[model samples]
Target: MFRSLWFDGRLRAVLAQVLIACGFAGVVGWLFWNARHNLMQRGIAMGFDFLGEAARFPISEHLLAYQPTDSYGRAFAVGLANTLYISLLVIVVSTVLGFLLALARRSRHPLVAAAATVYLEAIRNTPLVVQLLFWYSVVTLNLPAPRQALEPLPGVFLSVRGLFFPSVSWTGDLVPLAWAAGAAVVLLGARFVYKRRHRAAGARGWPWLALAAGLLLWGAWQGQVGLQSQAPVLRGLNFLGGASFTPEFSALLLGLTLYSAAFSGEIIRSGIAAVPRGQWEAARSLGLRPWTTLRWVVVPQALRIIVPPMTSQYLSIIKNTTLALAVGYPDLSFVITTTINQTGQAIEGIAILMAVYLSISLSVSLFMNLYNRRINRTQRP
Candidate 1:
């Protein structure tokens, strides 16, 4: 009976899986034991109590007011915010820039295509760190001093120090407009749902151009009620009242965006190209203009292909934000490393960093997986 079970393919597969799991568990157990023994021998403690200790160093820019006297917990929060800020900016900007690059590469004109190819190659071939340094060492360095900073538009200044732009000052009156904005968004979403469900029954084909005009008019009308612009005025050696992005941040953001944009463009280009050429021909035969055909026929089909890989790009940008340390921007990694150096709690600090990054990655992956599943179901005939 034992020999019969061993010889059966199903039984063999189950046994193989069990053996592999046991081996993995054993190795992990051994590693944990070894690490604990080593820590005991070295008389080093491992705990997160240091998180509440005072952080005696300063951060250049933080979303919240932080002092050298603030606890490491607060300091870490600052770093986390900074990392998310940069990562979010990079993800949005890179995706937009990448789509434009892909479109440029798909251009019928050879000049436009050639320009895009050169851009893709140049950014992709170079090391990201080098690109970051170039922006910091070369681009920012060559900018005029604060006194002579360029103000091409009122309230926006560009200097070697960095970009200084007007910051929004909100008033109580904007609350009603904010509520209206939410309602408008909900209405638009409902319209999309209605349109999709009755796509075949749509007798009133609202022209895309008219829809665009209506949206613009609505936005303009809304803006008149509560929106206002405040421009920065140059004062002292630096702009005091405006929101600022330090040179290091600007460099890191630009470098990361341009670098990742190359890959994003390639991913999208392949996705778009994978759509059968006959699909485009069919849309054209149905009397659709280029933009209309692309919007209605091409993008919907291309989204299924594009979204899976785009998730990876989004995660990559999140991870790549750690490279901010190279340019003297204190992201989460930078803060954790500094904590380790200051307190000699290497194990604890490293553990915290790993946990935070893992959490971020898993959260992003979960959201993307859900989105991918929804797309797959919708695409099914």
Candidate 2:
């Protein structure tokens, strides 16, 4: 009977999965019951109804309009947005910087290679919080006042408060809409033409240039160009009207990006190195130039190795955004912490925070997995 059951592959698989699920459910059920009993004995409520209660605390850096009288749910939303914003910013910056550093490590120049190595080592070895504090408190705070701010360009300023640049105000709807539509059309056309030409011979760089120029010209012709800048203007002992970047956000973003980039640089370096030397030789034998070999041959092979590990690093960056609490950044964790303390609803606050992070992480994983599958499908047999 055992042999017969084993021979029935579907039945055997189903039995195994069911047994494993039962064991997992039993463990989870026991934990839940034990926790509930403990809470009851201590006279502590364990439900999530407290999330509806008013959060009687001030949030300093709300992206949305929020007041102390706002509900706990609004506070949770504010926190989640801030966390996501910082994570997104840091990921973009770190990926760009890390890729550059990785390329630098592979440079023919000895000095460039040494410099890249040193940077990688220093950043990886330092504690992230310490680096954040140093950048925020020691570096940014020590900069000159607003009146004496660095003005490298007209209407743009950099100071201890934050970097300020002119922002465009959209007045006319049709002009801006038309410009956007035209730009999209140009970009799509350029991409199509470039891909067609590239598959044929790969010797045309003008399509991209033409697309960019066309977009710029179209946007300029539209009445969509307007500039206004209000850098920190000192009034007595304080500044006004300028976009103020809180030290918390600056520190959190800097720390996460710098720390994450170190690992990313190493990942990239390893990925590039993992591309076999024989592949390099093969490319050269095909009469490809050195630059073309790297661009078309080595890098593509390296990307397959690079992407999986890079996805993990990206996830780490997202999770580390929660560390904003340490530096008093009003990220999700900090908001949730404050909410819990004010409302005495620890369970609800913690649950919401966990759910938000889980959702964000799952979304990122889903996107990356889709891209990974596409890449895998395109790989040479």
Candidate 3:
């Protein structure tokens, strides 16, 4: 049996793979061991024991209730929330602005296309940190003082102080809204499953799926229509606000959004340009309107090229949120830096920061990969 196994090509290949795996594992183990030994020799504690210590420094911008006396763990959580909020905001705003700019690039008017090209070039050529600083300076220096805040809309004020706008404030019981949301989710989930099954069976249910989604949303909205709401109003000195954005945060958000959008616009234009010329000719020959041809034929195909690169852009947007520190926005990177300086645990602080960022990137990649897979599966005959 041993002689037969040795003579078999499959068995030999398997043995080679096993040996390579063991060698790789040994190398990794040795590297880890050497690092640990060096760290110990330097008397630098590598454990995460400092996460529980009190953070005596103040974070200027945080989502949760965090005091200077809060534990580093709590500070970390606040910083994380701020990071996530800014990231999400940038992703959405950049995506919409990017698509619009992409459309402008393809506009029939020469002025529109030229303007978009100039805008895209302006953003793409400059470093993002410079853009952040520029916006910060503009907002802080150019805007009117709070006493003479510019009221762009009634109850909304913009000034050197910050931007103040109304936000949704719930005054009634939230249980009903929760129930409606739950019902909508169940309805949408079932509809999604039905669509998947039909898709696998090579049957189409576009109208049914649309109707189901519309009904679900409509029902949810109707159920929550009577919920109490509040709106912010302008007060004497400052706005009696629903939500207020500090100058630092506003500038950081604007800079990131505009900068990311330019890159996204280039991705979109490339995706749309990738479609075969024959597809356009075919659509035009069928006597379809320009908009109809684009919506029905061109854009759908372009999405195939757009999704993967767009996913990378989304991850980039999240990673760039770290630059908020330059604009004085207290994102995760800023908090970690302060924590590192105070605690003298540079290693642990950096490790935590790396882990958090790695997790966020992985999460974005995972979601986008799944979406891309669904698109691929549906495209396959």
Candidate 4:
């Protein structure tokens, strides 16, 4: 058996792998030991027990109400939530805007295509931090005081502080409105089914719109649209009575979204390009309108190509949210930094930051991988 093991190619490969892994482990262990020894000699604590200590700093953008008396653990959670909130909002806004920009890039009008190209290039070339500061200082901070706020329209107010819009308050019974909208959606679905069954253009292309309008009108008539505006009121030297947006948060989100959307737009463009010219030609030959062909044929195929790379851009935006610390945004990294300074727990703070980022990256990767697998499985042979 020993002779056979020595002679077998598979056994030899396994033995080689084992030896290499053992060598790597030894090297890593030696390096870690040397580092720990140096840190100890320098009187730096390397353990993570400091994580349980009281964090005596205030977090500015905490999702849950946090006080200076909270523990380091609680501060970490607050920071994590803020990071996630910004990332979530940016992702949604960027994806929608990017898709529209990408579609515009394929427009028949030369002006539209040129404008899209310019926008994409402008966003992509600028440094994200620079853009963030530009928006904050030039756009947001330069606006008039809340009392003298710029009103773009009746219910919307913009100022140096933040945006103030009419907040929706659901009053009357929303059940009827919900039922009406749901029924309209169901009817739209049924129309599609009927079109497929009968092979006819369904109701001259306005049935869905009419259904939506009818439902909206019915809902409004029933007083289901309960919304009121509490305009920003000047209180002493500051604004009051409306939602306040911190400049740091706004800057971080704006920078992240603009930077990420550029890449997302490119990914979409490339995905559209990946669809064969023959597919477009075939689609056009079928008498389908340009919009219809794009909706029914091109986008579905492009999505398979677009989604994976798009996920990477999303992960990048989430990671880039760390840059918020530079602008004093109370994101996870900022909170951790404060915790480190107050507690002198470098190892603990760094460990917590690393763990949080690693978890976020891993979660994103897992979801993207699952989506990629699903797309690959459904791909045409």
TM-score of each: 0.83, 0.79, 0.84, 0.79
Tens digit of lDDT per residue, candidate 1, span 167-247? Answer: 776544554556555666666666677778877455454654356456555654655544445666777887787588899
* Tens digits of per-residue lDDT for model 3, 141-198: 9999778889899778898889987776544445655665666667667867986877
Q: Give the Cα error of residue 63 in candidate 1, in Å.
A: 1.7
Candidate 3's TM-score: 0.84
| Whole-structure CA lDDT of model 1 | 0.85
lDDT comparison, 1 vs 3, better candidate: 3
Which structure among the candidates has the greatest TM-score?
3
Query: Candidate 3, clashing residue pairs?
Result: none
Candidate 4 deviant stretches above 4 angstroms: 1-3, 168-232, 379-381
lDDT of 4 by residue, 26-126 (tens): 99889778867887888776776766777888787777988888888888888899999999999899998888888889888999999999999999998
Better model by lDDT: candidate 2 vs candidate 3: 3
* Candidate 1 vs candidate 2, TM-score winner: 1
Superposition error at 60 for model 4 (Å): 1.1
Please report the TM-score between candidate 2 and the true structure. 0.79
Candidates' lDDT values, in order? 0.85, 0.78, 0.87, 0.81
Of candidates 4 and 3, the better by lDDT: 3
